[model samples]
Every structure is written in structure tokens, then in C-alpha cells.
Target: MSSPVSVFTPEESRAIKQSWKALTADGLLPVGLLLFERFFADVPQVRHMFSGTGIHGDENSPKENFSMETLRENDKFTKHAEGVAAKLSCLVDNLDNTPAVMNICSELGQAHKMYNVKPEYFDRLGGVLLDVLQAAMDVGLDHPTIQAWKKAYEVIAGATKPYL
Candidate 1:
């Protein structure tokens, strides 16, 4: 039966591990930049999620927007991505404990619900992340590698959705 997330085959897991190793050497900044770029481009409303002020009221700046240029220069963006990479690495490193890691993702996602994060953002992020991974790695990442990331994203997103 089809599910929100599927268990990766041993081969797929191996491919994902190799791809992630290359990505680690390259750093997560590029990946982070791509994430914010696609996020802002596809769902501009999410910009307020990371800003200094809330989405409404005079305290909010109407000019506030997400930009690839800005994301590059933004330390917060880089740092946030680094943290994400670290956590994701932790999860991937311990794929043997899939259920535990997934629980962490669900808890984290639920915690963000206080910030008014929507399930759709998780969906959007999953798709854009896959696009970024596939695009950035080019020929180094074959179809099976891409599929591994896709499966991983689905698990993360699916676990997150219930709390949102």
C-alpha cells in the first residue's frame, strides 16, 4: 500500500548516505540558500515566519521580503540552515532509529505550531528541498538518491502535518 513515507531500500539508504557526505563537504549554505529562494518564490507569505516582527500590525514592515541576495548575507539564515543540517544529519546518521528520529521531527514541527506554521509549508518545503537537492548535485546524485531524499522528506512532512 501507498503511504505518506516509505521505508528506503538498503541500496537507496546507501546512496543517500554517499550523497549527504558530498553535501557535507560542500556545506549546507548552498542548500539553505536554495531552500529560502524556493520558499519565498513559491510562498511569499512564509517570509513573516522568520522576520523580526509578527505578520500583522504597524510593527511589521510592508517592505519585508525574501531574496536570494538577502538570504546569502543573512547570518540568521545561514545559522538556521546549519542547525537544520545538524539535526538532519543526526537523524540520517541514526537511520537505524527511524521511529525515534521521526518522533523528534514531529515534536519539532508541533512546537512550531505556536508560531502559526501551517501544514502547507511542510508540503512546500518537502518539494522545494527535493528540487534543490536534485538541482544542486547534478549528475552526482542519480535517481535513486533523489528518491531517498524524497522519501525522507515525506516522512518528515507527514510527521509534522498532524501537529500543524
Candidate 2:
């Protein structure tokens, strides 16, 4: 149940912990919403996948009618977004526990696979996430923090890819 080696250096771990704390200080829901907004805007091709998620107004409505308010008001969508944020928090909390991190990421991978999420989408989303994190940071996501996040993402994706 244990990974053979740790994935993060001490400095990287500290950077990640500090930045994540700042990033989620307000709450996961807002961070989740911001992530979705960026994801939907940056990856329009993924819109169809969210059609049934009530993010695009309603189940039968066109995506062009999408609104932040619609997503905010939709309990299901909000919960889904919250779930995403929660999972990231789990990973961050378990940073020192490689097995837990692997298991978490693996479960995420399996779930996304069931959703028919493409492998490439993970890579694309990772980039968008970094951008969102950087922009969201008022104190600035410094070099070490960025590198830490990138490496953590690589580990997450690596573990997640097998199930995908």
C-alpha cells in the first residue's frame, strides 16, 4: 500500500502546502467555480460532456445560453465542482502519503474513464489549472510553487493515466 519513493522534495512540498492554503483560504466552492469557468472557456470542445451537468443552463438548453449564475444555482453542478475541489484537497492533505495520493488519483482516473473523459483532457486541464492557480494568487504563485504544482500534477496524471 506504500509507494516505493516520495514524489516531492521538502522545498516543493512546502511550496505546495503554502500556496494551496492561500488558494483555498476562501473555500473550495469558489475555487471550484473559478476552475470550471476557466475550463469551460478554455476548452469549449468539452462542452457536450457537460451538457447533462446543468452547467449549460439546463438539460435541454443550448450551451450558448450558459451562465455562471446557472452553474451557481444548479445544486448538482455546484456539488460536482465542490467534489473536484475536495479531491484536490484530499491529495494535498495526503501529500506525505504516497499510497493515499496514488489511490486518490487512481479513483479519479477510474471515475473520469467511466465518464469517457479523454486522456488528453487531463493534460489540457492541468495546464488550465496552473493558469487558474497563478491568476488566483494575489501574493503570486512563485517559481517554486509553480514547479511544485507542476510536479504534483505530473504525479497525479501518471497515476491517473493507468486507469484512464
Candidate 3:
């Protein structure tokens, strides 16, 4: 699908992509862990949502079973987080390709909607992500960077909101 009216400027897109790169360069797994840690901790009850069902990225893994319970420290979880990190990486990398990026986000929203991933959860996830990025980055997250991420997220979440 085509992207909605552009919500971000070229400068904003650059900042968002830079922030993503900085956060995940050599610490994708740890950063993902920290983000999910906050997500599960802040919304403890949501952890149960993955008790029986696996997290989003275990479809073709070598592991037979997967759950978020021990995922905070498990390799499977790291792999899982890597999958998501990779997706976000792709999206950020394609920031200039508006149609492709929006389409990907829309598809992702649809996929998550199958599991009842709601719009609010995206916002929560974004906040947790920013917090983790802020803590992880050497210079730390600045205002422009945060705004860039927020705008990028709004595009994604807004696309996903329809399914939610």
C-alpha cells in the first residue's frame, strides 16, 4: 500500500535512521532485551499473552518451542529480537522509499493484528524502545532524535491502527 501523507521530513527520517543505527549497531540483542524487559515489566499482565503462543519471530527457528518467559536471557529470544530488530532496521534503511516502508508497516500491522496486537501497544513499545535507546547510545537520545522516532512510529502505528 502507498504511504499516507508524509509525516516526516527528510531530516526527520535521517535522524530516525541514525538513532536506530546507533542503538542497534553492536547491541541489537541487549537493546531488544532491555526494550522488551520494560514492555513486560511495565505491563506485567501482557506477558501472559505469550505464555502459550510464541513471540513474533519463531516461525521457522530450530527450536521446537518458544515463549517469552525465559526469553529475556535465552538465545532464542535474542534471535527473535534480532528478527524484529532486522525488520526495523530494514524499515529505517528504506526511509526514503515511502511506499515500501508504509506497505511493510501495514503488512506488519496486519500480521500482529492476527494476535490482537493493539494500537496502544505500539505506543507503549515505542516509548520503551526510546528509553532503551536513550540509555544505550553514547551521546544519548536528543530531542530531535526522539521527535524523529516518534514521527516514524506514528506513521507505522497509524497504518497499523486500522487493523487494531
Candidate 4:
């Protein structure tokens, strides 16, 4: 089969790969925790969706009141976040292989659909990922590198939404 056409420019792919390397240099776990932490902070309403993940605190407690510490300490949540980070790594590693990227995202979209993940949440998570990248990286969002990440996320979201 012919390789799928990539929407990302070669420069964008390089920027994304470089940023991913820098972002995960410490390890994927911290980046994953930070990503989800920011996601929950920015979109507390979605916290309920992650109930099965064991990241949030007591169900009886107000959703907004759950301690972030609970999420940080939960093994299941940590593993889940790490898995997400790993998927991101896989995507970056396969940037030149557009079909592989689409396949990974399509599978994720299907899986998340089973969990009742909404189409809007994908954008929210993408926004959170960008925020996390900006905050964690020495270079902020204004840089071309972050801009490239933004483009990469758009591609991922676009590819995944069809399966959602």
C-alpha cells in the first residue's frame, strides 16, 4: 500500500520530535501526571468520566473538591497516564508514517468511545497537552516548536474524531 500523505511539514515533524524528546527526558510518568493534572484542573466536569481510573477521590466528595494528591498517588491512574504518554511517543516515533499515526489514533478513538468520551473532550485534552508542554518546557508556547506541537495535536484529533 502507498504511504498516507502527511499534513505535517518536515520542519513541524522535527520540532515535534525534538520537543517530545525534551519533554520526556526525565521520563514519561511525570509528563503524563502533569498532563492529566492540568486536564482535570482545566476541565473538572470531566473528572467523573475518569472514575473507573481510580484517580479521583471519594465519589461522595464534590468533583471539584477531590485532592490532586489522590490522583498523584493512585497506581492505576499513574499507569493509565504513562500509557497515554507512551502512545504519544509512538505517534511521534511514527511521524513520517502517517498511516501508522492514523491507525493508532483511530484505535484510541474507538476505545475512548466505549468509555463515553465526548468529541469535545479531545480538544480539551489537546489544549491541556499544549499547556503542559508550554509550562514544562524551557521555551514557552510562542516558540515554533510549540506551534508544531499544536499542529501535530490537530492532526491527531482530526484523525481520531472520525472513529469517535
The true-versus-predicted C-alpha distance at residue 94 of model 3, in Å, is: 1.3
Ranking 1 against 3 by lDDT, winner: 1
Worst ten in a row by lDDT for model 4 = 54-63
Candidate models: Cα lDDT each = 0.71, 0.82, 0.70, 0.85
Clash totals for all candidate models: 0, 0, 0, 0
lDDT (10s digit) by residue, model 3, range 1-164: 96545557878887887777777777667666667778876666566455433444455642233334557656655676666777788888877777877788888888777778767888888777777666655344567777677677777777667865
Candidate 1 lDDT over residue span 44-88, tens digit each: 888777764222324453524545565666677677767667766
Model 1: how far residue 110 lies from native, Å = 2.4
Best-matching candidate per lDDT:
4
Off by over 4 Å in 1: 1-6, 53-63, 139-142
Candidate achieving higher TM-score, 1 or 4: 4
Regions more than 4 Å wrong, model 2 = 1-5, 54-61, 138-142
Error of 3 at 52 (Å): 4.2
Arranged by TM-score with the best first, the candidates are: 4, 2, 1, 3
Rate residue 159 of model 1 by lDDT. 74
By TM-score, who's the top model here?
A: 4
**Pairs that clash in candidate 4:** none
Residue 78, candidate 2: how far off, in angstroms? Answer: 0.4
